[model samples]
Target: MPETPSALPPPSPSSSLPGLRFAFGTLTVLPVRVTRWDRPAARAGMLCAPLVGVVAGGAAGLLGAVLLLLGAGPLLAAVGAAAVPALLTRGLHLDGLADTADGLGSGKPADDALRIMKQSDIGPFGVLTLVLVLLAQVAALAEAYDGSWAQGVLAAVVSGASARLAMTLAARRGTPAARPEGLGAAVAQTVPVAGALALAALLTALAALAGGALLGTYGAVRAAAAVVVAVATAQSLLRRCVRRFGGVTGDVFGALAETAATAALVVLALG
Candidate 1:
């Protein structure tokens, strides 16, 4: 009895699968069972957030390709390409964008801005921002499609994935959560800045390689530049959110993602 020792506790279960499941489940309308709802799982979800975009973009791109092959006009194909992700994701990011716009456009104090963002109804600012961004996306994609369907597809996929990368960057360590709880608190400062930067760079490199394989040297350059634009856009938005709203919120994250995606696509179209 004098020599008796305490036993060690069992290790926690791996959260990778649950995190992936949660990411897809929360970020999209896909059927995924999220088994873990704790912070660790939430962090894991954020880490793998970009994968959801890849899947959504790939599916949307395929639909656009099929539409184009079926004699659809570039505009029509672009609409389908834009619509599929919205449908699959239930436009969560779009809704977030709208809320953030409304909040920021109010030009109120930080507390008031947060309150405005939390409201369920969309305001004039929200409506206007959504309309303009959505139009820009479709118009740019249509132009890219006119050049080549493959280019359009690549642009869509790259922008989609890059959008989520912004979220990862925003969540990097030391980022402040906007509130005591909710998505911002759950994921803010969860990712290491170095890890986020590395992941984003890796994504850009992979996109460049794919562009070179599919399109050419110019496409590769454009692809890399587009990533840079997207990341810059995201960081700019994050800075504004922190200055204007006190910290990043779920709505801010949404706004950042949509803004990054739109900017990336615009750059690709221009290229």
Candidate 2:
């Protein structure tokens, strides 16, 4: 008898969600269709970053509120607030942050650095980076916790939005991923300047609504600074990637996002 052809596997769940598609487009080390967004799509995606931020922030705020209601100490509340975003993103940034630390610290050739990052095991650099990142995040949360719950929520929103904006900047400035098809391509094709500006405005408005002049100014400054840092860092990474592997990768983008978010929150807290 003639054999029937094998059935194709079902499409992965990631193929369904726009956000997940975008995330995969931005973070995966493979090639992807980076050219879906026209100006509107770009704006939509950029704006979506803050929307995700708002959702994540609201969750963090709720977590903090519940913890407080349950008689958990301020420290725990702060930690929970920080952990919520990390958890929501499934520690994507944390992994990026860790890989970045290991890659950059190794001082090996770019290929070696990328290889180290791809390794499943965490290195000394990864551990140290995680500690520093968590420490900074915890301190920021602790400070934000002193204010009203609104302030905590605002902090979470600003941090999340600013990180995406930072990623946009990186996408613009950094080299494409080696594969020519993954997140790097999609982001480079889709993310636009106008959308980033709109996100900034939205973040500013949200901060004003949440805490008036003080928080508004602080959030704006923090976000702007984070963007600058993220762009610069991403450029540096891009250069390294090109020199080593001929292009950027998902890991690099993730690292940039996490670094930018952490810096934004810390600055907002300090401010």
Candidate 3:
């Protein structure tokens, strides 16, 4: 039998370096050099996924702050804030959100839904999902920044990191791939459960501390709440995908990331 992605060994010390390169090269438009593309490298890449989120989120936060300083106002600043990560990631997560919507909205058998997701054309479901989600993200960012630019920046970073952390959780051992080939198969069930949980906890603490530093007690509490909700939303989506589509596809991962980010932003905005 062919070795499955789940069968790949845990990432060793030497593989960790290549994994970092692979994570950035594949997940973002950062001009990083990736010399390894095998399963071990991909697994390590999954472990390093949140680091890419850190870079992307940090840049977005910085850009939003600069725009605010330039008198761009919250709305334009929000747009720029939201647009940076999308452009940097080539809107890869958005594409996943669209595809997942299409698949789920098809309301067909698992096989049929998977087939729908594989189609390159965007469906009505996809169009609507993208419109609503993007609108929510922009609106939430605007509101969060209305109070303070520092709060907005912290929120953006938390949302991005939270979303990537969701990916790490979903990829935890035993999660199945929706198909036998493609990106999903290459990464499915690659993350170790214990390691992912530890990372998630660490990120939550760090985000809360940063939020409190930037926005005070209320901000820290709200930030932590947002991260919790975001992770729950992502996990919920992953479960639904498993039941509806037999397992997770690359699109599912994308959808989780986008949904988690939006949820985090919205929670921070209103909480």
* Candidate 3: residue pairs that collide: none
What digit string (tens of lDDT, one per residue) describes model 1 on residues 148-180? Answer: 889888988888888888988898776788887
Error of 3 at 221 (Å): 1.4
How far is 62's C-alpha from truth in model 2 (Å)?
2.3
Alpha-carbon lDDT, every model: 0.84, 0.60, 0.88
TM-score of each: 0.93, 0.72, 0.96
Best-matching candidate per TM-score: 3
Lowest lDDT sum, 10 consecutive residues, model 1, at 1-10
For residue 231, model 1's alpha carbon misses the true position, in angstroms, by 0.8
* Candidate 1 clashes between residue pairs 3 or more apart in a chain or in different chains: none
Rank by lDDT, highest first: 3, 1, 2
Stronger candidate by lDDT (1 vs 2) = 1
Which model is ahead, 1 or 2, in terms of TM-score? 1
Candidate 3 global CA lDDT score:
0.88
> Could you tell me the lDDT of residue 105 within candidate 2?
85
